[model samples]
Structure formats: C-alpha cells, structure tokens
Target: MDKTLRRWAPLFVVPALICFIIAFLVPMIMGLVLSFFKFSTVTDGVFVGWSNYKRIFTDMDFISSLWMNVRFTIVTVFTINIFAFFLALLLTRGVKGTNVYRTIFFMPNLIGGIVLGWIWLLIINGILLPKGVTIISDPKYGFWGLVALANWQNIGYMMVIYIAGIQTINRDLIEAAQIDGANSWIRLKSVILPSVMPAITICTFLTLTSGFKIFDQNLALTAGNPARKTEMLALNIYNTFYTRTNFEGVGQAKAVLFTILVAVIALTQLAATRQKEVEA
Candidate 1:
C-alpha cells in the first residue's frame, strides 16, 4: 500500500504543480523579466537595466508608504494579538452566550475590505464629526483609522485561533499549577502564554501581512489623502503602476522589491517567534 501510494504521489501532485507553474511561476518569471525592461505593454519592451530600480530609491512616496506600513504593522500586530488573547481567555472561561459574542465579534471579518473601509469611514466620521474633520483630512487620523478598522475586523479571527489553542491545552496542567499555589496571573503567564505560542505565531503572521498589504481599506478610507500621505505600500505600488504613465517597468520593479521585503520580514518574524517559543 505504501509503495503504491508513493508511486501515485507524482500523479496526485502533478496537476497542482502544473497549475502553480502556469498560474504563478510563469507570470512571476515574466514579471521579473519585465521589471528590467520599459514597456507600455508586454509586447512594447526596451531593456533599461537598473534605471527603474534606481528610480525606486529616489521615490519619496514609496519610502513614506513603506514607513507608514511599518508603523501600522507594529501597532496592529500588538493591538490585535493582545486584545484577541484576552478576549479568547474571557470567552474560554465558561462564559454565558460565548457563541453569540463570538459571532458578533467575528462578523466584521466577513465583510469585504472595500465594504469594511466604507463602513468604517462612516462610523469614524460620525465619531469625529464634532472635531470638524475627517479621517482623510489628516494623516494621523487616517493612520489611526486604519488601525482601528484592522483591529475590529481581525481581533475575532485571532480570538478564535487563540480559543482553539487554549482549548487544546491540557487541563491537567492548570490543575497542577493551581495545586502548586500558582495564582491566576502566574499560571497564565507561565503555562497559558507559552502553550499558545502556535496561535500567537499564526495570528502575528496574518495580522502583520494584512497590515502591510492593505490597499482597499487605504483606498476607500482615505484614498491616501490629504494628498497621498496615508497611502500604504500596496496602494503606492498600485498608484505607480496604473496612475503613472511610462513607469510600468518601475512599478513592476517596485512590486518585485515589495515581494522581497515582505518575504524577508515574514520569515524573520517566524524565525524569531519560533525561537522564543522554544526558549519559553
């Protein structure tokens, strides 16, 4: 049976491999090739070597957007995970109507990003109506607005993951901690947190990437106003690609760089988190 399954493994994997190559690998390779060439379209191409990449270095908007996303990622990752973990703890504690509360919290995650952004724009504007301004009126407002929107949408999802991790923890461990005179706080610190590292890892990765790659919310919420100040990296890349003419190669180059940046940051986060998990 094992030998037969092994023999058929290539057959089982071939379709997915072919699809991946055709859909992703081929396009990625083409995009990379295009990055080095100037083109109005794929067919009209002229090789420009490193000029497009050099332009990225002088692109202050790209730099600003990159920084904005970094700050946003830091704020959201911390806020979302910390809040979700506590919320998960509360819900896991034999609370009444846990399912209902979970549903209420999780509903925001179901909304599409564009829809979410509009909903939040209305809600936030209403809250700040007396201030005589809007989220788009100030970069700070836009920044915090994005953060709040992200937290509201994502907390419940992370909470669910945390709840699952919490549930999987051995009840015997809790009992032992209690018997050994460990208080609730101490037990939570020592046992609960360390045990839920997997959930932390998953939530951190999701929240971090989501924060970095946010485009629709940035578009609908502030549209990078009051003059592209609130634009995040994804939105910036988009503006470069579509809004600017004769910069397609430069835009493509930016995209390749963005991909590299995301890959590096994500891998670093995973390695750092897994190391801490092991140490814990």
Candidate 2:
C-alpha cells in the first residue's frame, strides 16, 4: 500500500506542480528579468541594464513612500498584536457571549479592503469635518487613520489565532505555576506567553506583510492626498506602473525590491519568534 501510494503521489503532484510553474514561477522569473529592461509590456522589453533601479533610488516619491510604509508597518505590528493578544486573553477566560463577540470582531476582516477604506473615510471625515479638515488634510492624519483602519480590520483575526494558541496550552502547567505561588503576571511571562509564541509568530508575520503590501486602503482612504505624502510603497509602485509613461520597468523594479523587503523582514521575524517558542 505504501509503495503504491508513493508511486501514485507523483501523478497527483504533477498537475499542481505544473500549475504552480505556469501560474507563479514563470511570471516571477519574467518579472525579475523585465526589471532590468525598459518596456510597457513583457514582449517589448529593451535591455536597459540597471537604469530602472537607479531611477527608483533617485525618485523622491519612492523614498518618501518607503519611509511612510516603514513607519506604518512598525506601528501596526506592535499595536495590532498587543490588542489582539489582550483580547484573546479576555475571551479565553470563560467570557460569556464570546462566540458572538468573536464573530462580530472578525466580520470586519471579511469586508473588502476598498470598501472598508471608504467606510472608515466617512467615519473619520465626519469627526474631522467639524474641525474643517479631513483624513487627507495632513500626512499625520492619514498615517494615524491608516493605523486605525489596520487595527480594526486585523485585531479580531489575530485574536482568533491567539485564542487557538491559548486553548492549546496545558492547563496542568498553568496550575503548576499557580501552586508554585507564581502570580498571574509571572505565570503569563513564564508559561502563557511562551506557549503562545507560535501564534504570536504567525500573527506578527501576517500583520507585517499586510502592513507593507497595503494598497487598496491607502488608495481609497487617502489617495495619497495632500501632495502624495500618504502614499505607500504599493501605491507608489502602482502609480509608477500605470500613471507614469515609460516607467513600467521602474515600477517592476520597485515591486521586486518591495517583495525582497517583505520577505527578509518576515523571515527575520519568524526566526526570532521561533527561537523563543516553547514546546507545548
């Protein structure tokens, strides 16, 4: 049976492998190659060496967007995870109506990013309209507005993961700590936190990548208003690719850099968190 299964597994794997190659691997390789060329389309690419990348570095908008995204990612990563973890702790403590609350919290994540952005836009502007300003009136306003939207959309999803992690914890270990005269804070530090490290790792990676790749919300909410101050990396890449002429290669290059940045940051986070994860 084992030999037969092994033999037939390749037959099942081959189709998916082919699909992956055609759908992802091919396009990815093409994108990397195209980044070094000037072209409006894949077929017309003219070799331009590293000129596209050089343009990206010299572009002030790209630099500003990069820094803006960095700041946004940092703030969201810490804020989203902290709130999610606390909420997870609360819900896991035999709270009544927990299922209802969880559903309500997570429903926001089910909303489309564009739609969610518009929803928040109205809500935020309603508050600021009285002050004769709007979310797009100031870069700081847009920045914090994005932060709020991110937290609202992500916290519940992260909470669900945290709850799952918290549930997996050995009650015996917690009880042992309590019997050892460990206080709640100490038990959390020594046991609960370490036990949930896997969940923390997953949540952190998701938030980090999402923060960096954010586009639809950035577009719908601020549209990089106030002279493009709120533009993020993804939006910047989009504007470069579609809004500007003869800059497709530059946009593609920006995309490659963005991918590399996200990959490196996410991998580093995973490595750091995995080292601290305790056996459950």
* Candidate 2 clashing pairs, residues 3+ apart or interchain: none
For each candidate in the order shown, give its overall lDDT on alpha carbons.
Answer: 0.92, 0.93
Candidate 2 is scored at a TM of 0.91
TM-score of each: 0.91, 0.91
lDDT measured at residue 212 in model 1 versus the true structure, 0 to 100: 83
Name the regions of candidate 1 deviating beyond 4 angstroms: 1-19, 269-280
Top candidate when judged by lDDT against the true structure: 2
lDDT of 1 by residue, 178-200 (tens): 99999999999999998998888
| Candidate 1 local Cα displacement, residue 250, angstroms | 1.0
lDDT of 2 at 36: 98
